[model samples]
Target: MSCCGPTRRTLLGAMAVATLSSALGAGASRAQRNSLIATDLELVTVTDRSVIMTWTTVAPDASGQPVPVASSGAVRVAPVGSAPVTMYESAEPTPFHYAEITGLEPGRRYIFEAESEGVRAVSALNPVTLAPDAPEVCGEFTTLVPPPGRLLRTFALGNDVHYGETVSGLIVGDFPPGFRSLPDLPPYPEVMLAALLDDLRAPDRGAQRLILAGDLTAEATPSQSRSVRAQLDSWGALGRDYLVARGNHDRPHTGADYASCAPATADHRDCFTEFFVPREELVQHEIGGLRLLGLDTSELDGTGGRIDRPQFDHLTGILTADPDRPTLIFGHHPVTRTSGATALAGPGFILNASDSTELQTLYTRAPGVFLHHAGHTHRNLRTRPDTPCDVEFLEVASVKEYPGGYTLLRIHEGGYMVSFYKTRTPAARQWSALTRNEYFGLIPAYTLGHLTDRNHVVHRDFSGLT
Candidate 1:
């Protein structure tokens, strides 16, 4: 009675064939009738102009592979209205399939579906729109481009999304002796990145760029690297481009293990660079009229962080070359304070002050250097020039830790608005409460009364620089 069922004559023929095969005790014909199973369906947006669709398959027999016999499976993309849909045939072997669909319009919604082997399977049919002209909302911030004679929008930034490690141990390697706490964070980088993309796509304000600042993975392990790459691909699918900087965690550290795992430097870095970095030397974009420069501060050394001579010179040259444009420099580590050292504790965890000063000197020389965006200290803190300028040193909070959040900046004709948003996860909130308790419990009696004062005094304002 089913639509795909055999007709009377076809049924009779099948019965005769089955009877003959059974009489002969053949097993091959019976095995051929089994159904196929599909698993691990992934849909990715490769760029504003394209979407990459992929999935995995588990075949009945391992000897052969899944192949498209004809133009059977079709993926359709349509607009919000009753517009005519665009359809494309899927190419195989789709066991682990990847497809790049192009010619999409920016800021438009679309839908897709797939079918196979007389069985139909449909996805959520979720509405996915093309990325907007500005940085779409992600976390607490909307992106803003500074216009001529306007107030500059400042960003709280950080990168190196090496999640999945716990306080007790790393899921992939040995934990550093000094590592304090690591609780289970949500979505890891993939889910978090998706949420960020969704936020950017929201009808609200968008960021000029997330200024990834760098090292989205713990190391360039095949799995870890792939996970990070997938997140970037997803960002692109959402029609956003990340200003990816280089970080120590992204490249292999110098050690026997690193050498053994990564046979070639180019290959190792290529795994990440190919997907994240827009260019080899510099990645630049315009927000309003301001120029945002993402610099690669990652050095080959396995130590803390540094900018090699070439990169330093390159930064200097870029700034010198474009004297007229207001510049915002983004990197993974703060140039001024490598680690906080000289507060009551005497030395906090942040960029070393000497290096910080050195970098500050370079920035100060250029009147156009409006802000320095960094993340290494997982705390939300801001600093400005002791001497005075339109420049500010803004450190963003980590997506994985206590404050577990991001900063949003709004640039307008007069000045910019800055606000921080904590990660709105149930688990993160619980950990935040625990962190506060631990902070109070560990401090000395004298320090206890001053804790609130010290915390409140850390933020800075840079409207004068603009």
Candidate 2:
């Protein structure tokens, strides 16, 4: 359990549809009556204007025999004392039921009901909670309102989940002796991830959307990418509530010297793209009159980071279009060299100087580009350009290792503040404490934010955004 609020994981397990007490229909055959149990029921892809609910119903006879039965599923939405809207209905036997409802009005309250196997069930929890019901589900939910007061918007940033390696975390210089070779107890990435999500979902957290900076998988292999995406789908819908960027650890190549490999292309690859987000890897979106830009810095070699020309040009277009527009640019690698890495060569800490210089010039011109959030360094970093950078560069620690949490961005009309919150679930706190054993306990001193890294407030005259 989390100290912050009741977690989604608690609700997910609590609401399994098969075990709920509900009325049994009398019109069915004996086997039909015996086998109408629905399990693994939940909702995902829940946006302000839409939601997708999914579940699996196993119609097993009392004798534990698999019986073929025709099934249909649909979602209903309505206000009090009104005829409910049938948002979606389908008979596709994709081994489960997935129904979606769209075209909803934000900030309004509505009730949702899921019907499976011709039986309807309703849940007391809100649809945002996505709690299941007996052979179905119903809940009330209020769509998220636009960010309040001077705050134009809010987003949660997390990275370095490294979902599939199940082994050593990101210690990527000379391979440490007996590190990857040593056996891991088990994959604890999920525990850390669950904690992070719970913290993000907490009512006091106040993020309207989530953006993972990068390093989403461990090995950058196909299986790692697929596993990460699958887990994310269960956590919530990717495109609807959250988005991800690519990292060196998430590139399409591998080495099993720890046994690994990933087939690649000229400057781009499809492994991360095919599964994570179907849209272009480098893209920008405008929200609350501010632009949010995510960059893919995963290089061909997979160790260092670099931005290709195509993405740079695309970014140049955005920055030049209106250098005055308040924008947030995020990527996996830091352009400025990282502190606390005294043992490593200077080159290892950041992208090459030429790449850094090009961006520095752009940032100097784009006065409204106030912040840059990055990952992959797996350490908390706050850096500013030497040329009187108005832009505050913020780099967050990894999600799967060390301090193990994420940063929250609160953008207001006057200015913005960036705060780091450690994922505070019992499971996360336990794993975070245990995982400090990583890198010979040196990980905590640096990866956990020190002073300026965790909480930094910047004041600017951005009242013009209104």
Candidate 3:
């Protein structure tokens, strides 16, 4: 047998070449396999106890389904000095993905990954820290202490981003014939958010979080959802945590078949649940002895603009649970009226008279709820202080349309300060002018003018219990 055609050495050499070719071919095949394109990957917000993450897919899959990706992308979350990476996974069919990572240690640096199809594409490494503690990315933030005094840095609030929609028809009953499409508007929600974050990161000031009251999109469309998420991710890059709420637009509409409005493969609520609800609601973060309580006010259909009984009960429970903590409540709708009219009037109008009364009654009785932050109305207006409870209502401006801006809330030992910061970018300024021009005739004669107007006041006070 050894005396065969080729010598042993020749045969061995041929076998080695074949093995090499096989290995090379396998490697090429692996490389050719389709990848999970990652999009909208972002750290939305980070509180003292939780971190919010959200992202979307670049394209739909072969089944025409929006691909679902979790916190498994190129980003990984790790405690400041810890090595163990927290593993996050998504269920499936994700066009827009959102995850809330909880049980985080306060003021500790946490690293996260944003991977696409098993490949690490981007990394939000050591990107965020739990709230109540200052961030280490730019530098250390002094923990806010209680009364007698501590410097409370100012932060902004924005809601109803409503990307991808033409605002022309959204106002009143019909779209003006010559009106330009909202998509053409400059500094769309995404751009406005970027600018807002930049203003927050400006030198010499420590702006902590950007609270998004809700209605992140015009409707829960995949593209719209992705657009909003992308804007949020951009803000996260600046070390800002976006506290979000669910809005009427954030939910599925009942028109025709409910399925038509929702992601084809996932449940109707999946879109909203994936991108909005954080890991934990009822989050309590201390800003110098004052606690901030972010509540979920956007309820399912048939309950829009109104807090359901369960949520009402939950508010009472949380207040009773922590009676002593000076707390701020954040939601999509205002709890009181600006005038005789309601703050949220059904779906089309601002608050209705009855809706305001019901919500006010519930809020007045709740303890620890001193400051209520809202942003469904695009206008900027501060409500008269409520008696007994002494709660102050702040309706933040919208990011996508006219007078596009946000409200800055500063909490200190004596009390707090609230101011509206108008996005001064060219695009924002242009939109502000256009909206004023187009809606001038129709503008509510009673409410405050554009948020950018000089008369737009930054109502300040320490008399309220904080």
Question: Residues 1-466, candidate 1, lDDT per residue (tens digit)?
Answer: 0112222422232222222212111223222223343322224222224444432222222333322122134445555443435355555333223344567664455554434453322211111111121011010111122232443554434454664333311222452221234234344454444444455534332554566766676665556666667766665631145566766566554444344453435433234454455323566677556778876656554525665566667777877787656677787765543234422222333444555566677766677776677665454556655444557766665554433446555554444445454433333433332232223222111111111111121123333344
Q: What does candidate 2's lDDT look like per residue over 15-56, in tens digits?
A: 432222111111132244444543334443333455545544
lDDT, model 2: 0.60
What lDDT score is found at residue 96 in candidate 2? 44
Q: What tens digits encode model 3's per-residue C-alpha lDDT throughout 241-353? A: 66666676776544433443334233443355555563224444554455566656654553346555565566667777766556777777665544325433444344444
Model 2 clash pairs are: 123-138, 255-260, 256-259, 256-260
Worst 10 residues of 3 by lDDT: 123-132
Instruction: Give Cα-based local distance difference scores for all models.
Output: 0.44, 0.60, 0.49
RMSD of each: 18.5, 14.7, 21.1
**Angstrom error at residue 158, model 2:** 1.1
Which residue runs of candidate 3 sit more than 4 Å off their true CA positions?
Answer: 1-149, 176-187, 237-240, 254-270, 278-288, 299-304, 339-367, 385-387, 440-466
Candidate 1, 17: how far from true, in Å? 72
Q: Show how many residue pairs clash in every candidate, following the order shown.
A: 29, 4, 28
State residue 185's C-alpha deviation in candidate 3, in Å: 7.5
Q: Could you give me the TM-score of model 2 versus the true structure?
A: 0.62
